[model samples]
Target: MTQPGFLFTGTPLELTDGEAYHLRKYWKKGRQAHSIQSLAAFDVDVDLDALRTLVQLDCANCHLAHVASCCEGGFPFPPAAELLPVLDEHLDGIAALLPLDVIRHLLRKGLYERHLETAGHRTIGTFDGNCNFCIVEKNGPACMAHRYALQSDLNPMSVKPLSCLLYPLDLIYSEEDGRTLLTALTERTAAFSRWGPDYRLDYLCANVELRENLASADSPNIRENLPPDVFAPDSYRPAYVEGRQLLTELYGAPFYDELHTLIQGGRRP
Candidate 1:
């Protein structure tokens, strides 16, 4: 099965039968394993182990500190089919939120026309190393489209690219067994073929040790050189806990419920 083009560019990791089995074994640990196994009867499958390992990230901190942002990494324009609904329904709202210059450029360049010309697959334009739609803010860069959607009382996902929404957490479809796998970037997954780029090394959000080291540093230079509260461990939380809304939105409440049940040792309120 041919995978649909995503905003981000990366070869999807295809797991061999043996590799798949091993990955499953790696997941079958502790009480969570029982819940992971139970998911086979559900509509979606998850990489609970990988998700559990991702402890914390402060996106605002990362952006304010001028760290490498996924937005700055040029990504493809989501296929026209994926964008048409938004443009058809909310184009005016989006245009209203963007700077006049950007709107003028889009009009001159034929924003909708470009989607058709590129056959729904082309690199999105960038300015100053960030996505052109990004508005620079004192706190951080924000997507104008997303902001517009929120202001209009619309779902941000309706306008935001799926790739942008599902960062860190990767949804992989396997041709080998015809299964859809949900996983994330972890040390083990980074070593193996996994979705998205291996960002476990330097990205503060992905590296726990780096965050800890930065958080605890006492050197005068170290203290002065970095952003205030950069990589603060206090901001950290389990990936599952942090990603509750996204997970529920993507996989439905039952899927997230099962995950929560397993993580909380079957405790329910």
Candidate 2:
């Protein structure tokens, strides 16, 4: 029930110092002009090929709808107060097309200025009861806020919460150096491919018949792990591109270009 925020965990992260500082500033100030730069490479276990092959994918397939629900506890990233005002100007016609609860939840969430002092510390998400802004009809799922954002000329980053934008991808920070590393909570890298088939990417490579490990490296004490082989193949091209975008957004374009150059001479797994 407690939606503990990844940033609020206060752990020594696997990211670069600059990136971590950028996220920390976000926690301190709701909206900030982030300095998208890297301090060092801490979580770059996989190369550009593996990095490029990962994907965030559609929310319909993502468990985030039923999981996180924007409940980043202790994280100070709040929704912008001016978003609804901007949406109101654009969503007049779009509101009718959405589900009633979606419209109602959006109205309820944006009704007043919610402050941490008045609202108190909430461990769970503020609007997980029905997802605050999800409007599901016969035609599949649609995010009302995203729709309104698209119609309006407003920037979603200025309006929507960062937790929503950075779902699954947790930008963890280091305490001493303020380094930050990006990671997917849903997946994890084994200690040098200790787990059978590099399970961090198992779900993505389900179709491929990967080799099984002698034992699981899930535990810290596990000794024997597989070699860090390039698990990503040609089939995972889409995920690679998606993952690249997330990296680019977080680390800026230059970092991505440098990594891409390194992978150009990379060999197939």
Candidate 3:
């Protein structure tokens, strides 16, 4: 019997852009409630308290009922050296509770690069502080706060709220039926079945999630105007072919070759 052929559908996205969108959205919306509950009207730890104050001050006018659409798919706000003193003042409390150093490093790099293109600063990289996804190098040494927490024997990852831990993973799409779906094709079987063999892996690799997050947020128009950055060309790609290619890349010639033999000899699903 002939095996079932799968077709690819959906759009592709830039991985960097996806990461930026996730981070900004989480920072802007995901933590809003927490900020109100934990930080608002409090002045305990300098750093945490300051962060709470910042959130409260900024969100005093959060008129938007649904937060999902508010995120503009933008990069993180670059870390400001001006905020260093505030961070330093609350370092003890911050370091005690969370990965202060890591947070600082990421924020600083973001600031240096000016992700949002702040007023009077439209440059992309004046100091070339962008990370090429090398977590250890960019996310480590610069983060003494994170290192400090590790030395104290705390589960930093657990202490981190869902927003921080679920950075790139927050990518999801929502359907009219209201089901949330993950887009990362981390497995071969999944890639073949959900995304189609001919689907554009490049876009998939970048856009971890889809319209779901955008739909749930304040910027509902994003789903309609998500630009052809990743999804346009992907709609026509076949799943079986793309799946076969992905499988070959992951398992190598010997494994894929053997798998192909087995698949060809088996009945269609």
Report the number of the highest-lDDT candidate.
Answer: 1
TM-score of each: 0.68, 0.45, 0.23
Ranking by TM-score: 1, 2, 3
Candidate 3: lDDT of 214?
A: 41
- Candidate 1, 67: how far from true, in Å? 4.0
Please give the range of 10 consecutive residues that has the lowest summed lDDT in model 2. Answer: 187-196
User: In terms of TM-score, how similar is model 3 to the real structure?
Assistant: 0.23
lDDT of each: 0.54, 0.39, 0.29
Give the Å shift of residue 159 in candidate 1: 2.1
TM-score of 2: 0.45
Kindly list the per-residue Cα lDDT of model 3 for residues 181-227, writing each as its tens digit.
22222222122222222221212222224322344433322334344
In the range 70-183, model 1's lDDT, one tens digit per residue, is 455543345334445554566677778778877777677545323342344443455445565776664433677767776778776677656565656655554434444555
Candidate No. with top TM-score: 1
Query: Looking at candidate 3, what is the lDDT of residue 219?
Result: 34
Lowest summed lDDT across 10 adjacent residues in model 3 is found at 51-60
